[model samples]
Target: MKNTLSPSFSRRSFIKTSALAGGGMLIGFNLFQACKPEAKPPVDISQLNFNDFNAFIKIADNGMVTIFSPNPEIGQGVKTSMPMIIAEELDVSWDNVHVVQGALDTKNFTRQVAGGSQSIRFGWESLRQTGATARQMLINAAAAKWGVDASSCKTENGTIINANGDKLSYGEVVKEAAALEVPENVTLKDPKDFNIIGTDASNVDIDKIITGKPLFGLDYKEEGMAYAVVLRPPAFGKKLESYDDAATKAISGVQDVVRFGDKVAVLAKDTWTAMKGKKALEATWTSDSKLENTEAHDKILTDLLNGKEFKTMRADGDVKKAFAAADQVIERTYESPFLPHNCMEPMNFFADVTEEKVRLVGPIQTPAGTARRVAELLEREAEDVSVEMTRMGGGFGRRLYGDFALEAAEISKLAKRPVKVVYSREDDMTAGIYRPSIKYRISASVKDGKITGYHLKEASINSNMYGLIPNFFPAGAIENYQVDVAAYDSKITTGAWRAPYTNFLSFAEQSFFDELAEILEVDRIKLRLDLLQKVKGTTDERIQYSPERLENVIKVAVEKSGWGNAKEGVYQGFSAYYCHNTHVAEVAEVELENDVPVVKKVTCIVDCGIVVNPLGAKNQIEGGVIDGVGHAMYGDLSFKDGEPQSKNFDKYRLIRINETPIVETHFIENGLSPTGLGEPTLPPAGAAVANAIKAAKGIRLYKQPFIKHMKAKAPLG
Candidate 1:
């Protein structure tokens, strides 16, 4: 049977529904579905033994709140931040909350995909209502016990108090609350009365992480779990012709060598033995013409970018007329290279498969997709496969794909035993689902310091980004606007990385806007703000984002960073973009150290609406800036003859602590719904740094890895 996923519910609709399941006063919710159980009787609360909530919150007899963080924690701090929303509304202290990782229950949860920074944005209200409903139930129970009016009693800090000053701990009243009916309507807390949210609450896993606890996907273990490794094709467009596994089977500790289509797996007692057996396979592949090198790919991409009318994602007022009548027509092409997720923990998953059912455990961004894919590969019902999420060392869009988890399931089924498939750093890097290489052509027709028309063409692998407007910024801000997408197919596996298209696209678009400012003799920040001014109060139906929010962040970034005034020895660049429903404006300050650009500081202003976790939000912005800067300066992944040239960290680099700059983060709180913190913070950072480099070096670096274009003869500011 094909798996069907339910769509995410908006804030208002989510709170209007409730699923009261399990024994205690439990409120269950899922990103994809409401609380759904699989052929089990409703849990009884009379026993006082409590476990397993509906889909999210499980209230224990001791009043222990186990909030299931539905999204994967690829170090984005969702496991801690999400539960805060629930706890705050539950009238409970943060210290009283115990967070748990949620699993794949597509039948219940709406969707479990972790990428795109949808955790907070999607769960903002569902969780709050889950908590509020429970609080109401608890209050009702206490009111019934005292035979007082329900409104006469109130809850605070996990307790219920009556008007007569009689008090009861939530733990003492939870049993009675479990027996009461779930309230339909709950009064949410006023923003001014919030306790756990909008404050620095330490990550629930902080102590576990600091103490080096085994909580990550890499550390997942199960009884009698054998180790497995796969020998994938060395290059793209190649298929495994044959494999000699006899030598692999002869090795000590090697359990079996099983070939599965384009790949072969080596099963052993341990990881080291499995790796050795995999190496011994010596798999051969059929070599064909390959998609070779960045330069070659660039040529193909350029043709695709400019060669055709292609899919016009968006078109505003007469773009042709505006461009034809322009005083200055400017066009710039930007190339963003392929980037690896390079997660600290390489891809790995543990699968226990039998004739009737399969169970999986590991770190993955998308549990629902994993279960669905594994069920398909195993030729079983989706309900027969269960996937449990573990802590991820890093996702960055890498975990969003479920291929690694599927590979583990296949090996487990063939071996007929529980097995853990581990990918060595080299294997994970070479076995690619890398971020697609992209070429963007941004052009505008300006007349007297005003952009009369705009056009953007993007050529990339697989599908394009989410349409032209709403997902793409600066849309609606111009009258004559047009955006087109074209594609160039390749054998290379490509998937979302970090912010997906926005990660690379933002840098290119923002850099071009900076160039536009340069030619027009205007402030880069002011130019963007000016465009936003045109966006104000637009009645256009395509406008999904609030221009006021965008304008606010830009204004804050300028005011807070002191736009025109530069710090000593620093040249500043400004960029603002809105994506993932979050608005961000960034100012990057740079200095030339030994003729190389060194990012000295970055001041970012965000308008993600209400601030959920202040410090955590700051951390997300800081991490994103470092990640974007590191990529802009050095992140490059390319293929030569369909083979990945950079296989490990030694070859594919990441930002180090020594290279990290001071990041100042601020948020605009306009009392709107909370948006995502993870990805929106990342999209504009690269562009901010790229523009800063141009100001510092007196040259526009069109391509990524600005260092690659540096010349020794050029004078640095």
Candidate 2:
């Protein structure tokens, strides 16, 4: 692995030269060496067990080139963005380049799973270096033929040009470049000279999306593919007593019925037939299971929140003393229910099983993790199991949990035939993993109209949103703070959903700050600016934000939203959050309509280090904001007697076009290392909307399904 933190080249240089190459393509180069490279075994350009990969620029004898990617794109715009990165680095015309999905051969490709908004961020450095590295080799090969110094040569549009105007096409020089030992420490262009990196170019994959090409996992098809669906226990721990498969087999189109463990699966020739067969089974399940319903789970979490001495995720300073010294102390508790990802395409997988090996292909976030699990389940060598990732309908952390894929593999193993397990909308929603419900208790003190301290205790099912603690947030924001966390381990399973804990933390933290400003009689914007200033560069050993960067976004959002100014009857709320190396600030304009708070508009300023693709990044932020809004105010997954109450979109609400607010986005133009935008922007939105509602209604809400909390308190019709 190469050192990711080194600084070798700036992005500006690549942009300048890219423009001079005639603006036909945009390439992003990530200079990993941070310095000149030392001779080493040329990066293993071999196709092997890898998940994230950018294939070698394959130039045919006819001058056509193809750029292969192993990352599955699910509309977060990886298809458009990643190809741009590769084309930019290769100095190839975007028109002449064909981008395609790579095979799941780990020895040959990176697992093509896309989530965490990391599609572009991961490729930003390597793709550029790969292009630069290959271009230099080609230049050297062409220069050797002309008896000229390579320094006098420039590459343009897949051809090498010497000072004397002599040129050779890349296709003509590849043989020589291939024979030469890969060069060491090739120089990269300066950011000031860049033409492509900072420029706005159209996404390369837009055409495919518009035409509805087979670009996603749901679109994948194989010959002799049997459709199957698993009927698992209603809740997490409920087990099967017995099943009457006789009726299921009588259903038309039903092929075979197989029992693995706690559940049975019905296989058929198509999705509709398999689903019909499943309903016909009407299998009996034991009620003596330990799955807790929503109400019971809520009671357990609420009880835990009322207790003291929880496990601490972080603690600093004497929080007890700080709260004691204040003349007034404010405490608030907030809660959010579980949510489903509901990726548009639903969950499905195709697998071919044999006695010696298993080949599984579907939309998954972690290909290596899936392969490992499949290997274990099949009792086969890990090397014998292979996974090919398809463009997911949506990930949002749902794909991170491989239950759907596992179910497919288990069915394929038992049926002794290649099978594709497809989940109907209802099955996917009810059987899906969820974002854990959480309860947060926040306390802060104010002394004579000045802020003093803040303390938080959070109760949830897991420590991190995605089960991975990157320390990307807590370590960067807040000061003199204490964070205590306690989890309620239940049969209900959870996994990372987009921003994960950042979503809830931002809502809790930012909303509380807005309330704190109210208590201090300070402007919300100014209060955040002041708090940000205190921690910007203090060596106080408690600050984690880039004060200047955070402050810049705060200012931008304020200016765009016309903050510090007022309009009667129209309320505005502001919130900012930093995570995944990106800082986002948003201001929501809101009003109460029909006794329900409605969001009118939201203006956002996002700084994700350096944006690899402006259009794609914008789409991601917009989508994430809308997603957060729906989850905070509308989305709720509940249960009764341990059975999920909400089965599909009809019951589980989603934010539709009519509900989507007018969103205007601005980017913070700082030439910093690019961070992920996928899940970062989601955290601040719930809080921003919550704050807006407070301004609109003069009341604070501490629970999600925000409208319900509001309606319950208002007079009945």
Candidate 3:
């Protein structure tokens, strides 16, 4: 069966057209072109003009096709996969396609942000249309030349073939295609006929990344650009009172010291000098609010949970009545500490601000929004600012906020010269914007050996879970289900980190489910299957997960992991979750050595719809699993007097290479449009390992950094 492009293009909606000076064609589709009336084609074929399109495809006389990807590249492989989508419909050989990053152009592009792993999901259809439109136009041109019906001509690897054996390369017909009217309808290839989509393709930037070819933000440099390092307040609740840079002025390579609002910056010829000058300056700080500590945070969150000030996120049925009639009630509390993004390339941005315009170049997840913010801060029109995005070392939700870029813009405006702000490891760690410490209290009611009611309460430092998360798993499966949220506002800063709320919440809920299975004396896998069976035909539109897809992944994980069939000395744990529009299931295998449980391997099953670039998809799944397991085992961040306690890797703990377990990944291909893959596989990893440890050693763990609990239970020699 074949599928035609939907919505049928409007006559007023045309692919913005242009022609290369060297006799080639340029065709593109603006995401918002449907809203505007199409302009008439230019009379001059050699100089056709269109400036409104965002994503573009250019055919060169040398048979090369260039694709412009309009989303930020945050190590999520969009730079590679997006172009593949376009090339698949373009009917071009993969070897002749080249990918380039498109600059920030809010006027032409839509959804230039990269957070939430939605770049591919949002751009899939539009990108395919861009290619299919270009290919159709090329075929029309060749058909006109051969005096045959356009439908009778077919394209194969950048060449158009007529039914009578006449042929023309794309480059040869591009000139005539530029003068043809944009087709109102174009046919899209069936998934079964796809050659470049389902097949594996290496990352477009793999060679540059491996060869260290100045691809990351930290590698960006400009002539006569001054390096600046800012000195922020030591604690979250404190503000700078005064600063004296008399000694800093004497340092070699030092240019100037400036202050902006509550922070001071030292500009020098190089990053090392800027850092050295920053250390030499003296500063005083004053408290703007009460200093907070980890102990205080714990008490505040616990009080919030016990208080009656929670806002109900979702309520499915009469939870009170269900709980009252239940024969048994089970409850537990889970705690997780704050975490840092810890990107391999620390925070950095380059800004060149002047009277007329502002230029920014760096690794930013939200390029369009950041440019707007810079314009607002500088009191300039949005059109006066431009942003260029570089490949990021890692984002993990850290680069979503543009605070670093703002600092660079402010400093550059003050100095009247281009400036690049760099952060040392300690600066990156202590400057705040961390994952909020969170606590989850879950309660479930059991009646006649079956679950009846489910209630969950979330308490965090600054913000609560997003509004849509409560409608995820278990919302439709359980009849009497309720979700509540509470928060404590603090001077400490916090934002999204990796999977956000679900990272810890999944562990809490999944671990609690394991306890429920134990109490009911039912097979854990069967218990989940039974729950999913109840939601087969749910009418709730608010429910965000697919029961059928989730069940399939769970079953696949069970079979691949050989659940309940591990060899001697090996125990297994299972967890299944859905988030970021993807369904994932994970199983952890554990073994005990000298009374210490060690995780040996993890089997992960994922259903993220169509797999674009299998090699890149596997990397995302494996990386997410390792990050989730490592953070659950050893990651922790504490605060003392409103200041982060761990300033560097020496004080903070991460998963060591030797401790990392083998990760086995499996994907369920349903041939649907691709969903997010970067963060979906991460949320279930912690719970799988925690449950496995419980089976291996008969201990239930509720706190993160599971190593702490293991050490407390260890016996003296």
Candidate 4:
């Protein structure tokens, strides 16, 4: 069935009206939508592009329907689930629909992004109302042409039917609808009447993924495009001093060797030639060896714990007095090191630049930001620059930084030719932004075997959503709560890595809670439940978490896993956290052999407000658990003198199929507006696994990559 355009209430419209009613562009909330035609036009599938057209619906002359997604598709299955929302309201057969990727037009696309798991949730209301409104307009046109009451006509399977048994195909009625005025507001279907939504829709791009179709940024190729490789500095803030391009120019297929900014680019006929030319060139780098090495970095972090001047993130009541009055105080320190993204495809971009216009195509998370920045750097108007987004091998927050896109645009402009900058696996690992290293110092007071107060101080490179989110932690919870965060700025660049600070914070907070439970001689589950009970209804100045949702996820997890009464020989640990509007609880089961902890199983319970696509949601949770476990046990990025220590997979290890853990996922059933799933589920696995290690062996694992030091600890038995 061909899906038609509709008129409905949009949050964008409401926000725009409110903004206008107040003043001008105060919040920079620009509304992007499909252009309203002077006279209605039929939905043409092939006319879809990233320019000024947002193809919410495309009806072929043959009646086949297509939905264009403005967001990038990584492994997340957004390519399948978002279309389901439109199909539901359009009342079309799923078998007749096709999904496509969106491009880099800020005026046409709806905030092109696949991160934060907002693809389905953000588009849910807009797409549904669009489809429903379009269907009504078509039915009205058909009824008017047949000289029958619109109430007597029903639309089903792309056809209009009357009570008199007369029928007309949607294709035959398109002309009349094209001439009709779209209604002001179209009624939406109730949740109970949904057919295509709330179902497990298979990923529309799965076949392409499995068969290795050309769908990723790495696979993108433009005519007359030559691959370029940049020779970056060995250390952060270091710049190129000089380079001898004799050998590179001597090589066959090597083109002009141009210097752009801090590095020289080796332009060649293909990726292999560019790489070969880059390796053959001799370049000198001026470095500051005074930069903190791995050992020095650790010492600085450890010393911060002793300092008296730490920034207060959260504080309530009197923490010093509470500690003084307590009969017992238990304190511990936890540490986590930097980690690389290790995306499978590496970083790549295709850029074509000229005096009049420039075109950029790649796997980028922020198309609008890239366009704005590129136009600024090129000294051109924003409209002259067009971005085409492709599927990323993986995002994990690295793509949002726009480093690769900027490099590609600069190189193409300098080379004055179409260029595709391809980063090798070595380049990707060594030159990418890393998850910041952190130190967590947690202290809790236990009076008469009951917890009284808690204090947590975290120090790390600040790459968190500090400015983006209104508040880092909810204002309510512990009465004498104290959270102090210290930002250590360095020459080393940092960016978001997976769930950001939540990954390390969860590990530290949940592990500390486990220790507190032991000190108080109370059940861990009961302690958390008690804390939730105390903070649930309490008031705070800012927005606090909903106690009911917090308790619900924990309750479901403990009950399903038989938390306190599990079978002997199997040790379990639990951790729960909230991020990006989603709540997740994870339980890890593990066994220690020769003091090395191996995760045997993981059970995850998620409350993402609403479940958009059941299968896709499960995939994200399961993948997050595995990814987190792998990173905590094996991932590490250290530096020697000022240079990165590990450059390839041989030096850095990864979790394989044989080492995979059995992951079980469950979703809290509800019709609430959906939240995010991509990053929230990832933050709890490390903390859960660390807690399980403590449960198995009466020892505390306070640092990341636990295997490195676990062998010297006590046995599980």
Best of the candidates, TM-score: 3
Candidate 1 residue runs with Cα over 4 Å from true position? 1-48, 51-54, 466-471, 711-717
In candidate 3, position 70 carries an lDDT of 64
Question: How high is each candidate's TM-score?
Answer: 0.92, 0.89, 0.94, 0.90
How many clashes in each structure? 7, 39, 0, 2
lDDT of 1 by residue, 305-355 (tens): 758748887888998999999998999998878888888899999999998
Could you arrange the candidates by TM-score from highest to lowest?
3, 1, 4, 2
Cα-lDDT of candidate 1: 0.77
Candidate 4 lDDT at 63 equals 55
lDDT of 4 by residue, 1-717 (tens): 232334443434522221111100000000111122132324444563321112455565455666666666667766666677667776777666666565654544446665665655666666666566556667888899889888788777777899898988666666666455655656666677767777886666554556576778889897888899989887775779899999999999998798987788999988999999999889888777476588978888877777876777667788888899999999999988888999888998988999989899988877778888999998999999988878778888888878888888999998899999999988998885888888888888767776677788766754333212213332355667677766667677778788765777777778888778877778887888887777666655464456678789999999877786767777898998777778788899987656566799988999986675788888888889999899888888898766788999999878877777898988898767677787788878988898887888766888888776575464332
Model 2, C-alpha of 220: deviation from truth (Å):
2.2
RMSD of each: 6.5, 7.6, 6.4, 6.3
Candidate 3's TM-score reads 0.94
Model 2 gets an lDDT of 0.72
List lDDT for all candidates, in order.
0.77, 0.72, 0.84, 0.73
- Across residues 161-278, which tens digit of lDDT does each residue of candidate 3 receive? 9998888998788877866777867788899999999788767666566656677899999999999999999999899999999999999999999899999999999999999999
- Residue 46 of model 4 has an lDDT of 58
